[model samples]
Target chain A: MQNTALLTVENLCVEIPTRRGILKPVDDVSLQIAPGEILGVVGESGAGKSMTGNAVIGLLDPPAHISGGQVLLNGKRVDNLPREQMRRVRGKQIGMVFQDPLTSLNPLLPIGDQLVETIQEHLPVSQREARDRAVAALDEVGIPAASSRIDSYPHEFSGGMRQRVVIALALCAEPDLVIADEPTTALDVSVQAQIISLLKKLCRERGTGVMLVTHDMGVIAEASDRVAVMYAGRLAEIGPVRQVLTDPQHPYTAGLMGSTPGASLGRRRLNQIPGTMPGLNAVPDGCAYHPRCPRAEAKCRAEPRPPVSGSASCWFPGEVKI
Target chain B: MSALVKIAGLTRIFDVSKPWLNRLLERRPKAFLKAVSDVDLQIEERTVYALVGESGSGKSTIGKVVVGLLAPSEGSVEIEGVDLHRETDAAKVDHVRSDIQMIFQSPFASLNPRWKVRDIIAEPVAARGGDTKGLSERLLEQVGLAAGDADKFPHEFSGGQRQRICIARALASNPKLIVCDEPTSALDVSVQAQVLNLMSDLQEDLGLTYLFITHDLTVVQHMADTVGVLYLGRLVEEAPRDALFERARHPYTQMLFEAAPRIDAFGREVDPPKGEIPDPINPPSGCAFHPRCPLAIERCTRERPEMRQLGPARVACHMAEP
Candidate 1:
């Protein structure tokens, strides 16, 4: 599976050292994305979904560094590249779309200038050629009157339009992989659908591998080919999207689906997991999820489950009582 | 059981104009943004009524108006047939006011960081010179939090726990109507389920009426007894939750339902919703949604549709089928 993958993350770990103790935010996480495929990484706020993405893109902030494992791009290790070299690899071979469009953009520069600068920096294109390509990129993302809107400030565009501009900027370099972390979480539903379709179309047309990180299961069902469910900095389940959504194996995964209001219908009450996810410093022994897992046993609490060798990392996978 | 809350012809217009000097310099007139326009809805006792729309669609504005945080520029809001805004009796108004409470979207920002959880939850009753002894601890336990947590600060709690604190505060006064403006939007799926389930159980126990405002269709479907679909401040469709989800009437409502990502809709290709929401300041001439309506016609663009009955729904669309 890794041989044909465009991006493969093998046992990646990210740790942040605090005064009290060391925090492992991303622990032994592994997944892959093939050309034209989207693999969704979903978890709660502290589940380390974004940390894994940041680690893969070499954007992990200081104090939180990749402590172990390798991130390979097209079978070539990119995790160990130097700062300057990795900077080049980021824009030239990988693109990123963050949760907030406003933060991702430069307030002072017209969008056109930003796009042109990025294209010229990575693609050996002339200024005029880059300008034309910028217009094309904006137009392709469904921005109306792309030529005129290119010069507009980020504030001038509405929330949805700003997100489209962000998507355009991410794709201007035509990277082989795109990591969109909560790309549409900030937009309205109608606009969110537009952005989702646009991302799918653009990636498929370019055969760009996409790692979409979001907490919304609906987005995962709509866009991803495969889905990875994370819990307390560990991979709980990973499989085809349909299989995971319909028959989630891990207790955590099943509880997540059951708790989400709209995942299913006609229930008088949501099947809520009893406890909050354990904090990084206090992650329980054996299984990180055993504290909240309905199927947890003495074995689960005493020792960690083996690394994910199948669809789920659970001693009692698929045995959760509804 | 009668209507616990009734809103009639609610309209709120905000002055979003440039300063007087700037307007004079720019040769412009004062501008107004109609946040909510001629809306009417009622919540039966012990039921949930959800107002759902895009960000600029004025769902939050309506929630604010209903909760008495914002006065309506036109129309009236009544709780149990007593108009709180226009009641001549001060004592009567105060009594009505004490029955309504609001829970905001962001639990972090809404809470006072400096205050302990006990004080935060007891403020509603304490401010009224009512008994607050053991109130915070009891409510905390009721919301599924430890009674001991009342002495801790808000920062010590996780996002879900903070939301539970917010819920405890909202329940402090034993309010009949709680305006939840995206209360669970800031939470993870499992945590959201926990909070939502708690809210449902509380309503059943206390006979609470919830004015639930959110942009999440799935959440609305799961929590709302009745659903109102808004577009550019206008209520486009109002129906029972199951009726609207099973067969949406208005084009915009249908579009919203289609655009929402569904767990059952894996691998389904939804036609992206057409066009962005029009600017609220300078809305289109007639129906606000005509610009994006797939079935829009000349009449739709020229005349605003009025809400009319159509098979268990009130739809405001020229093209809605009977």
Candidate 2:
């Protein structure tokens, strides 16, 4: 199963050159997603969750580029591929669902046209066949009356429906991997559940790998098979969802679990980690989390802790009582 | 305990229809969206009253109305027994206005980009003709920021810190009630924990009341003393936090609780909430949630359920029992 991983990121480092200095937004991150498995990358805003996702999909904008390591899709290194080739790989092999569906989609075009265009661009299908597949894709994502709804413009549909349409667009070409960055964050709770289940079902049926990037631990707990916790551009913890959430080996992971209201019952005050996450430029020496970590010691600030044999990167691995 | 804030039969309607010429050309009637419908709430002093609902449920609309940002099309809002809309005396209205402050969801959008942190926090105090000298510095310290950091701009701080600044600005007015509309939704879990802890601490130290609005059930559980479940502009259930969480009386409330993914709840397969929230413009007859409610009965389709006391909870569902 490990050898047959669908997507792999090995010691990936992304750097953004600014006037002040070179900001390593993503540093030495490594993870793998098996076929038909969902790997949830959980972190705060500056933790480089989206940056990792963008790096995987070759969507990193200018001034920011992968400085080290490699991204392998189906055993082929795609990170160093040419621009046009990478663009081709995006729609054909790896699909993406961003946070906002409106911005991802073209408002001027109808849903049907967009779907058909993407299908035709990626696959060697005729316009008629692409339209049929487009309708089928919409229906697969639980859009009611897909045949009729396909003609509607984006604004005509509600927020939830537009999101479903976005999902359909992502999966219409039948990509092997889907990187959804906070896909359900913009949705309502009920709709969020629907979209989550829909994504899981569609991916399972198609045997597709998924990289689910979100800050919500609940979503991570619900949708992910394996979870990766990132802190200040580094991997803090990566393991099975159950183990990472229930028995977090890293202090950061433990703090996150303890702080989540969903993880605790009653009105107990959350166990807060002191101070905010350091920016890319100001990320401290040794452990990025040492400044705010409850279990931080002199050793933690003196040397960067390497990942334990299993997954956690911490000076002291195992649960720390809060 | 006497209510610090009273919202009686609050109703807000938005004219979302096409223009007269467009409607005439399209041969369609005018459309009015009933955003909030006959909502009643009594928020006690030093307590948090949370309104939890999906989008279009009018939770934010109610919060806006309570904070006097949006005027209700009908009904009354009373702060300290003075009707904000109906108070004829200028002095009484001013007094009521000064007692209320609001913190918006987006910290980035809420703070002006050009203004320094000092000027931003002092704006509220200055508006009321109060001396702004050293007010921002004091508030920055109170909200867990350095007094000297007031010289910086909003963009200089992280999202969590920006939210802290927003809280400081809200506190600058020395208001008795603060309306927080999805305050931490945009934040990460760890940062969200910090902000939530800060809010809780502030509430205890300052004896402040909060009209908290959010869609996250877990946050509601942690922050709210009393929780109100809204569906299609109607309050379907209102109960003390423990009562609501343990025994959600209304079907919609139950569905929301079940559909929401919980970090503590592992290995449990979440059933996606059935059906979507009905269009607010043409809501279903009777209970708005009846169309999607699993326990909905024939009575639920024809006649709307009135809010009735059921043990510790107030529910508007025919099938719900004490």
Candidate 3:
């Protein structure tokens, strides 16, 4: 707690008491983001990437509760922060920009107004001062005509611009950490690049540690300092970005990388993992990815603990090669 | 080479967003949003031509028009030299349509929930006056699905399998040209790779020409022989896959490349792709992308640049020569 890791999650677990029984979407998971560094949490849909983000922000829907573990922001326990305290911490200390900029932004309000309101809420700044700060934030993100476009509504702006506005809103308060959950997923490839660049640029300039969650491996490789691969709500692998992506130790992580169309072509086709993600309600008895893992054996049937080698969960991760 | 498909100046204007009450009260201006604007492209026999753009960029609209879902306002659509909407007879229309088929985005929605996979795949064959004997078993196997999968409901199958059933249905018609509109975007990345690989394999076996439409650059990299970039109802750049990837001339294209997170390069700060694509109804004067262009010149503000050949790429940008 005394160390300045910026944010740390230790064996975080959340449960939903459904009609059937207690179900866990995010199992025992632990990760960290250092000050000014970027941590990428990646997985497919229902892999708990968004769930983890939502849990961190206290925005989890009803019936969902943080059952066990601890979350530390700035070395302070934040798992059970009160609603009012959490609300204050949300925009001031840890900002968020969602996947769809259009939905995240209030389409009825002008972009400038939204940013100004966001800035003024956390800080005791007048509308004029907030507007000035908004323009400055927009400019910092490389948006053109920061002065004029500020007055335009979200509909008037393009997808990339709208995302920039969301970024400006998130950063105008100058938070210590920004949780961008699939920030560029909704934009075009070229525009997706711009938003990713802008997010990385601002985080770098302001020394804002970022928790970037996305499904794209390319984004993780390009933007993240560290990478965490989640499977069935658990962290299958976590390491240096290049180490985890290029030479994955965990079979789940390796399968994910192999499944990507652009990664390798000598195999002729994606090395398919035999099956799809299991339904969230049915928890696997042992290694969650055993169904799709190619190298699974009898040992895989026994519930495996988190691998000690470079932070992975596996039954037979013999040695740390990297 | 005999082209399998040809699109010349394809344009479709839709007046959405105007309510009935608003239209009755005041003389509401006919808001024409050019969903698919002027464009020229050719699909060579058995080759895949990919059109890539974000939502509202008219890539899907063009697919819709090609499949006669919507008729183009100002351009012509030809399938093997037969026009879709000529003042011609029904025999010609039937003949033209028989050679063209389309695969939709969501397999869950596209494949009826109540129907078994066998009936779903056989519907197109029944419609197109094709043989249905042993079709389901063969097509299912081709897509890597078991023959027993044909007896199950769509809900029983995974997304990838459901999409395979959709592919089987599309194949039922045995079209020379298939317009695939973001077919894999709704599935997981791993599943997407499987489906894409399957599509490529199917193409190879059937000698099918694919007009693959997607916003994901990775998918384009895997499936496209030629790539076209669209922005606000216009085709901004067209080039061979490698040429487009290596030598994109359009500022928007350049920005797009920079914005997308890539796999090989990790841990670098990226900028926003480019400015947002403007509204097609009231697009920016001169170049549609001028307002957001990082290298916008004076010429970009005054007159719209026509698509011109530069190097091996065809680009619509005043900055192309530079």
Fraction of true inter-chain Cα contacts (below 8 Å) kept per model? 0.84, 0.70, 0.80
- The digit string of per-residue lDDT tens for model 1 on A1-322 reads 8689999999999999999999999999988899999999999989999999999999999999999999999999999999999999997899999999999999999999999999999998899999999999999999999999889899998888898888888899999999999999998888899899999999889999999999999999999999999999999999999998889888888888888888658898999889888889998889999888778889998865656867999998888844
lDDT of 1 by residue, B1-322 (tens): 7998888999999999999999999999999999999998888988899999988889999998888889999999999788878989998988988999999999999999999999999999999999999999999999999999988999999898899999999999989999999999988888888889899999999989999999998889889999999999999999999999889989999898889888778877889988888889999988999888889999988899999999999999988986
The local distance difference test score of each candidate is: 0.91, 0.91, 0.83
TM-score of each: 0.98, 0.96, 0.89
lDDT of 2 by residue, A1-322 (tens): 4479999899999999999999999999999999899999999888999999999999999899999999999999999999999989997899999999899999999999999999999999999999999999999988899999899999998888899999999998889999999999888888898898888898889999999999989999989999999999999999999989888889889888888887776655898888888878798888888898878889888765555547799878894854
Instruction: For candidate 2, write residues B92-128 as lDDT tens digits.
Output: 9998898899999999999999999999999998987
Span of 10 residues, lowest total lDDT, candidate 3 chain A: A313-322
Query: In terms of DockQ, which candidate is stronger, 1 or 2?
Result: 1
Ranked by lDDT from best down, the candidates are 1, 2, 3
CAPRI quality of model 2: medium
User: In model 1, which regions exceed 4 Å deviation?
Assistant: none
Off by over 4 Å in 3: A106-121, A124-156, A265-267, A306-308, A318-322, B15-29, B128-134, B249-252, B270-274, B284-322
Residue A262 CA displacement from its true place in model 1, Å: 1.6
Measured by lDDT, the strongest candidate is 1
Q: Total backbone clashes of model 3?
A: 10
Model 2 bad stretches (over 4 Å): none
lDDT of 2 at A257: 84
Q: Could you give candidate 3's per-residue lDDT for residues A1-322 as a string of tens digits?
A: 3497999988889898988888888998888888889999999988998989988878889889899998899988887999989988999999998998899988788888888888888999888898899999889877788898788888887777778888888888989999999997776676777677777777777899999999989888998899899988888889899988777888877878777877864355777666788778875778888877767777776766445355678866623221
What 10-residue stretch in candidate 1 chain B is worst by lDDT? B261-270
